[model samples]
Target chain A: MNDSKFPPNTNRVAEHIVGLPKSGIRDFFELVNAMDDVISLGIGEPDFMTPWHIREASIYALENGHTSYTSNLGLLSLRKEICRYVKSNYAVEYDPVSECIVTVGVSEGLDLLLRAIINPGDEIIYHEPCYVSYAPGIQMAHGIPVVVPTYEKNDFALDPADLKKAITPKSKAILLNFPCNPTGATMPLDKLKEVAQIAIDNDILVIADEIYSELTYEGEHISIASLPGMRERTIFLHGFSKAYAMTGYRIAYACGPVDIIDAMMNIHQYSMLCAPINGQEAALEALRNGKTEMMRMKYEYRDRRNVITKRLNEMGLKCFKPVGAFYVFPNITSSGLSSNEFATRLLNEQNVAVVPGGAFGKCGEGFVRCAYAASIDNIVEAMDRIALFLKR
Target chain B: MKNNILRLLRKNARLSVENIAEQVSSDVATVQKIISELEDENVIRGYQAVIDESKLSELQVKAIIEVHIQPQRDGGFDNIARRLANFAEVNSLYLVSGGYDLQLEVQGESLQEVAGFVSSKLATIEGVTATATHFILKKYKEAGRLFEDGAEYERLKVSP
Candidate 1:
């Protein structure tokens, strides 16, 4: 008898491991991590810790023997809090019991949603220069990925005409991410309405990732799910990551139609019993009592964003002012260097690590994504180093 | 002078130095010198047939597709990228710099046909995460050819 417990050779394994060709952010982090006294501007996650109260709550939960798995949909209280949170903050209502499912993180929520909705050969519509996970997730689900390129002149906003052109009979869904990663651009209410109209007209489902809803600097973040007739068609993803600096907690939630939620939960149940019990407890505390902490972090991020934007522009880099999230995407094409070259050189020469724009997508070639989640001191030092590099 | 030479080349790539000089009303030496420089730089690699768009009514709709992807365990995006590159509808494939990972330039007869290619063909492939599609509204410029002459001047005049 063979004593080896070998994994099956399923073709599905090949399909699951997409998007490995280019992971510049991960590379940048590794490089930075390996360097001594490196001033890294590469990471997208917040530098702050989970709030004290939220941490305490998780500790309490663990101490009181709340370690077992909750419902497949997650703790009812957490789902209820998510419902209330979205409704109060963005005017979106979701049925706590039927419509919402707690996820390990927004990343996992995205994976589950794709697994639930995408069939082999289905097409998913998304904009270029978007978050990195969307395409690979679609591929893992055996779905086609379609990209609509957004122009930097438009601050990377989705254009309706462009969307209209991309639609085909094969399109099953669209993934919309606002307060977007890399760019930090947020869609206005009118734009959200337009996107909703497009989705309704085309009979397409939408997966709206609004994880950075609580971190908007210019105006309140709008939810596509809140639009008329959008609630049924939209799956809204949110989490305690950006707003509460709970990156390590890895807790997130998705709210959508009951059927979709159920499908996603089915996948979630088998794949990972539930989001970590501790993470769920911590997220609950975050939703309940971490509003002040959220605001404080948001303010800090906004301030840093402004500082970075001003400094980058002053140094002759063309940077669009990001109204949400904590990233500044500055066009470094004028430097006469490709994005990868600039990023690699910056990291190696100046000890400043920024993700090259090309790492995000082709449209990002001339740009560099510098996350401003670090402290002001780091930001200032990084900028100074960058200026020296540019001058040279 | 260069514009005239370019225009002549666009019409017929195989034109000789004397023939091009005659067409553009320039001396043979000047035209031949410019042609040599363009060739030396490899910008004018070699000219091929310029197919008439109207002749190929079979290819109608043109689109730019943005694809997001994740890495697979063993194969990664290489296999998927190669698969997409192999599609007949794909004119160009670019590994992009922004939100989406891959950019594909594709063509079809109708929007539905392109959609079919996406759904029935591209999406079904393993390792694809998400996709967004943008259709070409107007060809303002392509392959260094101006779509609408004087449009830029008109806009500039209207602005002030």
Candidate 2:
């Protein structure tokens, strides 16, 4: 049905929903899905399967007639495990009873937190190139998204100075994703300390999406909440998606001060009610016994990271070696094409698909994110094809 | 580092030295030296493909034979095990505890040939007290690969 038949003012859709821009990634994805024999280096999730034991736990849960809805705050046992995990990994403490609530995934957790906290027109400061969801998520929650550009010169690390400059009196929270997506950048601890101090000084809350923390290849991923004077003001979001290779399970959790967590849970109970019980059971198994497989996959990603980064640089893509995450954000400026142009031509000519960095934000205009989650052979072949594409 | 190299090779032995070096995060020279050292020390005995002989047109037979042997005064079962290991038909040999003294995986062109080996050669050996052979009927999985289900990447071609 062509919409041109309708009068100009006859539309009945919500103004905000209609005004929202379509996702750039979605447009590129349609083109990719229509093609055949494309080697994708664009997906953000893990290539590994969910470990058998975790899958078996969910199977067991289903077989034992555990199909009912869990508590509004999620299963008590799963929440307790999540708390313990947070305590050990982030060196922060929280009461499992009041301060934790399981959501569908980090995606839902972020949405819940934003809707719970954001007053209309409140500003959320985030760094870019970033995950594509942050700006739109904030906008959907009726908050304004303020972006600070992180450059390749600094290895895409968020500069606290710029972050400080972006904050305003209307700023409600700072959304931080260390070991970030689209850039594969992690904030330095000292910089994190500075950012935490700035937030404390301004009395702003922090919404930390640390979904990729476990895949850190460097020393360790430092949670901003762990810093002094930050725990009471930070919302920590993590999930079984990236680290556990359980993206399809849709199990993640949020932990914060009782008041904020209660607010998020209020929204959660009204809408999602609770995360799926089977996914929670699977996540419980993952938290308990999934370390070995998790580490194996992490090591594999690290290996692929090394090979791909080296190959990209050798082929004149000028990639920065990301210290964590399974992606290499290679600068494609040498090819004299915009990120989208390069991605389109490479896909059409060589059947190697990569996400244009511009999909993340404007700061990502000249580069493309090449996920190293693929097999080494595929990554090597993709690099070769990309090289050939550049040559031609 | 050695273990890491071996792990990559275990998955795919055909990787070039440069590929191995990149995967292991080492230079080619260092990887080359380490691989040569491993070869010299016999840590890497050989590289062979994992094959399912059942796929071939020619019919093949395989059997796991349990051998109960009497131990010599000084040599124990080592003398008999060494003698059995030299046979070309013996694919694998292990000295297992329990009812059986030694277990052997023997392969042949046919069931008759394998049965003949057990009767004429294995049973005739000194201190070979008893033998029981179990024939393998089919191959489902070999060397960490499934014959029926190959892993296909079912995820979307591109995502954010």
Candidate 3:
């Protein structure tokens, strides 16, 4: 009894868990949930339901009793499809047997990759105004997250100079999510190449989160993993959530060199065991037949983006015409309000909801992320309401 | 640009010139001009609501009438088709392929009136050789929109 590891009244949670800050948008959205008739543009996921055929495939699978766990690496058929998809789209090849592991989502894939490669105190350099989970994921894995601040002046693309400045001997990996969340910024080819070169020179591993690659609008999405000498140094993460509107299915995959993928899968096998079989079945159907619906949704988002961006700019919010993702990050400083103040007052006054840009990162302050993933009618109505609020 | 504007209008005819311009990535003046030109050219024939007539309290009988017509020597089926198109009961009329030369969607106040129109008016047309009429029972969907149950849904107020 006297050999107990800790005092009776000590805090039970791990130090890292205690250190993590709560989601920046949580309290603001909780207010949103209690409001009536709120037209929300705060959502990060697509408005489209998963297409019928893909859902039908999953139903077909479950009806036929295909509910058991898959191989830790995932069903062979699905892995083969993943390899094929990666090769055809990104111009990078991976062996299905040893170089791929299907995880719960790109979220899980990121977590697994971080856990597999990060040593205690190893630095993970990622850009700010990124997906909410990236920094926290690194920190959870006991890695120090080093932030590289990208600016609106460059359309939020990562400056290679910034990358070079952020790298250190302890910087184990650089996490890149182009056509990024929040800002909807994409890297031009030359800039992407420059960043790739910096990674190669620094001898840093790269984690490319490309879940939104299929949503790219202006031009082709270039994967850093496809660059010379990058195939061995990059872990490529892709998923069905954004592209297929299958966020609820929680299915994604990781592809990289054999040894690293094996390491991630080793952690995955003991923890997650495998991605749900029904999700794999749905993803299989998606890769086979989901292209038409996916493209249709992408074009819809593009149209919505055009209308929302124009409307926001018209109302005196300086909004960038983002060429990727379904968001328009409009600079709201003209309203003389901080991001949270603007979002809160807009919600309270107009019954229209948008995310405060500070929720993404400190660099995201003075802006607000308006998702164009709602119906054109709703978007138009929201824009009118926002205009009224701005006028007031 | 013309097709994109028309597609948006087709889905939602009430969209303002400003809204349409933004959606199609054009300007208001250009969108207004294109729409005016379209209307002048009859590329956009008319704008109307897609009503779910079944919701009305009054009786609304609709029939799909397939007509076999003897094509006129000079006018082909155009003469009879034009005549059929003029009838108030005919909601839509088209020159169809295969077993029928004409397809007519006719609406009337009652089944008797629809039957009377088909039998007395449609079948007695000089070139009409045969007619088959089928009455619509219930509509689960119309104009790409589901009717009745769950026609509208609201998504989560906020999400990550």
The candidate that achieves the highest TM-score relative to the unseen native structure: 2
Give me the candidate number with maximum DockQ. Answer: 2
Off by over 4 Å in 1: A1-29, B1-160
Question: Can you list each candidate's DockQ?
Answer: 0.01, 0.85, 0.70
Q: Name the 10 consecutive residues with the lowest summed lDDT in model 1 chain A.
A: A1-10
Pitting candidate 1 against candidate 3, the one with the higher lDDT is 3
**lDDT, candidate 2, A1-392, per-residue tens:** 35786766766767766667678677789999888899999888898889899999999999999999999999999889999999999999999999999999999999999999999999999999998889989988988999999999999999989998998999999999988898889888899999999999999999999999999987988899999999999999999999999999999999999999999999999999999999999999999999999998998998899899889999899978888877789999999999999999999899999999999899999999999989999999998999889898
lDDT string for model 1 (B2-23, tens) is 7667755775576677555643
Model 3 residue A266 lDDT score: 90
| Model 2 steric clash pairs | none
Clashing pairs in 3: none
Error of 2 at A14 (Å): 1.9
Model 3, range A45-160, lDDT digits (tens) per residue? 99888999999999999999999999999999999998999999999999999999999999999999999999999999999887888888999999999999889899899999
lDDT of each residue in B1-160, candidate 3, tens digit only: 8888877887789989988889889999999999999999988899889888867798899988899999999999999999999999999999988978999999999999999999899999899999999999988887777777745665678876
